[model samples]
Target: MVRKTLISNKAFGFLFLFIFLLLPSFISAQTQEYKDYTVEKGDTLWDISQKELNDYFLWPKIWKENPEIKNPDRIYPKQKIRIPLYLLQKEIPETKPKPELETKPEIVKEKPVEKIIEPVKKEYLVNKDILIAIGYIADSVHSVGKITDSPVDRTILGKDDYAYIKTDNPVKIGEKFYIIRSVEKVIHPESGRKLGYLIEILGIAEVVNQENDDVKTIITDSYDEIPTGSLLDNFYEIEPPLAFENPRKPDINGYIVATRQLHIINGTWDIVYIDKGKKDGLQVGDILAPTLQSKHKIINGLIQLINLRESTSTAIVRKCNNSITKGDGITSVK
Candidate 1:
């Protein structure tokens, strides 16, 4: 009798184990799923976003989802596409008993593995006048000192009694100056003239010595404002409303890849290096159009917050960093 009773109890335990394992799966009732799509010729990103996402402006999201598309404008015929679907589920009550508290697991963030590849380097084609203007603004806003002019051409305001600002010059006395070293692409909202990213300030030099006409060394750093050539001026304001008025036009794109913060090169006042070079189809003298990252929301959807999303900053490929790798900023409108 004792043996028979023991066998029956063992059978009950097995049945309970099987039921417990299958219960959660049956209660959740989730299954894998997918949607099929047929590609049509001349289907631009704008077209697909309008059809799939219901918002024509959401083309960026579609392109981001499908990096395989390559260019936003290019698509082929009869290409098979898979649309991702995020399932909706209601939160269920916890049923499992709480176990004894244990030590937390160590959080280790794995760095992305980047392949070692040679980057293409090309000479920049910056305009001398534009660089001058950019440099002027950079100094005035970010650096300390004033740019002054004399028969000597330019000089930084100095403590020397002989030195004085030529008011006739574009840069006035007590005005600050900055050197425009390089340009990088920034993003604007595709719909309007707005910034889509943080405004970046890279390299710069200060107006130092102002008096000597024969030898003018714009102080790379100084506490006093002096009339000098190191003092540069911004011919125009670097704002979206003051700049791009149209959305359809192709904008310059890229990000600051490297910088010479030390002000080593004579011309490298606030100089910034861009990822885009000649190989990815960019010239050195190219100027960047910037856009600030914007926020978004889903008006009416079950899982809008969780499913649909917006991005802060994305690189525009004004200059190709080569190998089409990460950290290479892309093109944008100025």
Candidate 2:
């Protein structure tokens, strides 16, 4: 009886030792499948997700692991990224996640990993109220010249009963002066967000002569400050969702919302300044559908039918139009 008891104790001790030695290796093997990645030029999270996980939208999952990817906008070349692929697959039901107590942990025999893919996201159109900041186009130093077209002098002359601006410098017959207004956002019908502002051409003045940087100037026309509720920018004009019937003809499509006729920059080729910006869901490389309009007879009424008037002329968004105004043209509606 003594020998039998001793034998039973020995068996129990051997079993406990075996389990203790095997537990850590099992856990370590299960969780050791994650890898790291380096971001190269033109590397995008969506592309990497597609290559690694076969789903582009799954990028947010990888982004959760790396909190440093703030402002999904600013990515540098050759940045390192962590790719987490070690989690065991639990079949998440379509409706809700399984409760922890209800699920049993299963060991993975092997870890499968995929190479990262860099995807190019197409640009998309958006319109929203955006904040506009003013900068100096040209600065004029003081010039002591005759002030013929002073606003106070014009009031004295009874030329017109209105407030006018004047300066003591050289003046010309057809010069233009600008009353600049800042930009802001409005409501969007599609996305339900307020974005972008409308830049308005306020007034025109002309230069008479130059003293130094300062010049004598006269107001040619008195224009009002762009009032509130003015039609600011047009987000929908990035691409008219229509096609042109004739490809050979030079088609006029949408209306111009804003323009920088004087300043042409890279990425602004043949592109008109728009009212819509990134706040309106606009992206950098979306293909916009150009369209046209025609009057058609519907049931018992006259309806304006917008037609897809042309082939898809893709507009690469160089910059978001932050100051779209109402009644502004998007593109030629052909």
TM-score of each predicted structure versus truth? 0.24, 0.31
TM-score of 2: 0.31
Top candidate on TM-score is 2
lDDT of each: 0.36, 0.38
lDDT for 153 in candidate 2 is: 42
Candidate 2 least-lDDT 10 residues? 127-136
How far out, in Å, is residue 31 in model 2? 3.8
- Candidate 1 lDDT by residue in tens digits, 1-334: 9999999999999999999999888766443233446778656554565566554445555455565765444556797654444311112454797798899999999998999987642211222222322221111133233334534444433333223322234343333333322232333223333222222322233333444432132333332334434333333333211111122323445443333222222222223334334444443223343222223211111100000002222122222112332223334432
Q: Candidate 2 lDDT, tens digit per residue, 224-331?
A: 432221221111212322221222222233332323322111111222333333344443333232222224311111111111112111132222324323333343
Error of 1 at 75 (Å): 1.3
Report residue 64 deviation for candidate 2 (angstroms).
2.4
Error of 1 at 197 (Å): 35
Best by lDDT: 2
